[model samples]
Target: MKHLASNLYYLRTRNGYTQEELANHLFLTHQTISNHETGKTEPDFSIIQKYADFYHISAEDLLLNDLSKKEKNSRIIFDSVIFDKRDKVFIIISGTKGTYSYKNIKKCEILNEKARYKGKEEPFTHQVVTGVDWLVQANILEQPFYVGLRLTMKDGTHLAIYTSKQPTRTQTDFHIRDVKEAEKIKELIDKIIMKYKNDESYKMDNVNSKNIFFDKDRQTFQILSGSKGIYPMKDVCKCQIVFEDAKYYGKTKPFSHRLLISSFESFFVTLRDTYVGLEIELKNKEKLYVYVSNIKQKHHSDAFKADVKVAETLKKYFKTIITGNKTMKDE
Candidate 1:
């Protein structure tokens, strides 16, 4: 295995940074940086974080084993094996999803037809399927498709196969089918967006009461209760708007919704300039709210104002907004 220390040394050297220069940037001693690069010592977690932050790279990339030379050498050998038994195996697997059964069928029937159609001689070796089955059952090979299989050789060479007379047809068929299906899904999504835009329940009865609206067609869940004004189903993160003219927004990353809720909590503490309690409801169920005491002080009010300013700064990054209050439940 290629060593990470060597890779780190190479990266630092390629960047033209001396050990002392790197150490100064990471807040470490020059000796420590040298030791890490020479494999004499490993850096601690804190130091690792500093190194990652300095490089703007994920820690996993820095810590993983280096295989650059080995990969290059293997690729050259695998490429030159013009009529190797493994090449035929790759041809069979690449035509189908990585599945042992499908590969067997293709090698027996499909391979002959493909060879004749292409005017190429029959591949010299064909019994490699037994070896492939053994490798798969031993857990050395990962099966990624029911009709296709991805084979990873011991040397790290990889091949894929799909089970079709015209293997390339699989991708084309999938794309055409997806386009047809998306049209149907889009119709249902449009209804949801319409509901949210028309829903009366989402309208603010009292600005103090927090509310959440769900648009099923659009697959959007919107929360509208605060001075920041109508935040569209897409803006909040829990949901997204896929169709351009839908009633409710659609759902995307759930973590973004949680992040928005956290932002709201911060908004309540800072922007409203009041210590009054705030409650959050999802799907008509009371989920979360916060109560803060000591609303009388000028400093406390200023803190709330500061919180709003912070929220406004962050708000620039998110642009989607809720335009109308239509409820999905009603539709």
Candidate 2:
């Protein structure tokens, strides 16, 4: 670790490898390499050996001696043993590593380049197409084809890697054509998300209004004081939020058809901007709407634009959650 950083940097430049090029050779991300070169972070012992192996040097020399000077006694070290036992998966975007765990993937989007062009029926009208749609449209105005992968990790790392010469909306490029491969990976990740979504103990808890949340593992949906039901995720057709009244559940009881709604006290009123309305539509065309909870807000104060962000996130979360569950049943 003493001369490791400087030595790596020196050897990479001596071998005419840019940080990214060296990173590719090492099967690591450019950021990780940059951190190592700049002494901001250290690599694992196994990773250090990879660097040594790449440059045909010993790890001891790589970490202790200054390679820029004459190395009269240095010898190469080679080991073929595999040590790590954990079952892991890795995707090389270009040459950088896309480290992911099934449980840690938040979103996997296959980004096929989008284009807008004049329609056949109306030259003055514009139509938009995405992904492989251009293969069918075959319009002259179609832009150069580009397809890429975008994934958001649970740790907040958003990675976008492209197989084409150009990226979708980011700069991570591989200059290789692997659009089909990207689509397959996205499908695999979607399954991972679905599998985790149904965990009985998995709950967003404070992330959204708890007045309505599903116990996915048990296939149960609950409400604060309105009504509760146990139905499979496949039965959920849709859901909506009502942000108009504070005591919306009291004013308009939801899902009272067969649910046992309990009489509960009302505290504060909810507003359109503040959010609290949760309406779930079942496959049978029945709807259930209610305010989040009487005392859902942590503080009683004037509503700000930022105050609504959490609710907005919850709305998106529910949409994807239900959509994922619905697709599983359909398949």
Candidate 3:
């Protein structure tokens, strides 16, 4: 076999180190270093690794002369480390999440595909397939980066490749409206009630429920529910009236609704003002509106104007509104 003794001798001389000095640095006997330089004996792998580290050269370079065809093939094994199927996909996960979350796909793609061959195919898919194939050919599924592939193909159909295991979840923190925003909503509700007070045509029942819709961008609120059911502030007083079907009211009798505000920071109110009995629904914990009487009332233009004004006043204070049955958190 060829030997690297000449190359070793050259490197030692080039670095201004004698045989004894090189031996001392490598923790080998001076005679062993002399034998290595003269090609009398080959050094063990541990010594070769140490020599590579000491000279800042690769083991492959130091042992290149001594490597036979079989040895050369062995070097190929080191070209790429074998990884499992699961490990291959784990690499793909980095680029996907980085692209989606940070909007940094350009950087991620460049870094990830550096060692990969250039092609027109999707860069991530190519990296994944290459990794998988490398693992499979080397029979290294048990290795740390190993992954399995189930591929299907037939005439006149696109190929299908399936991967196992879901990607890991990425955690993120988001800011939410604070208690101050909640207080602002409450203040807006109060203003709407005050603005519509004492209008006979307004149909303010003993149980009056108010729904506040919040405009987050504008930092304001709008009233959503009323005797006419649900109406926007802009249409509250105009000729544009969108009537709500009286489904909450039962058939054939007078109904009375009751509003119940709970101490748990939630609201419940019931709608019962037609043929149905008293049914309750929650408006808000601090405030609620319920229809308490079955008195039939007519809609007046002035009353409509008053309702619109109340909604307009409230619109300056709240953000996003939801109306539905309320349930206590612990309950």
Off by over 4 Å in 1: 65-331
RMSD of each: 20.8, 18.6, 29.4
- Candidate 1 CA-lDDT value: 0.35
* Model 3 TM-score (2 dp): 0.20
> What lDDT would each prediction earn against the true structure?
0.35, 0.52, 0.33
Per-residue CA lDDT of model 2 for 1-331, tens digit only, reads 7888998887665444678877776789999999999999999999998887665456888998877664422211111111110111233333123333445567877654432321122221232244365545434443444455556777976555444444232222332335555655566557756666564233466455455666643445665545564455555667754443333434445423222112342343221223344567777887655445444332234443334455565566566657655544443
Between prediction 1 and prediction 3, which has the larger TM-score?
A: 1
Off by over 4 Å in 3: 65-331
Scored against the true structure, residue 27 in model 1 reaches a CA lDDT of: 78
The number of clashing residue pairs in model 3 is 34
The window of 10 residues in a row where model 1 has the poorest summed lDDT is 79-88
Name the weakest run of 10 consecutive residues (lDDT summed) in model 2.
76-85
Ranking by lDDT: 2, 1, 3
lDDT of 1 by residue, 241-266 (tens): 11110111123221222212223355
Residues 40-132 of candidate 3: C-alpha lDDT, one tens digit per residue: 998888887888777545588677754233233322111111111111111112111110111111111111121232233433343322233
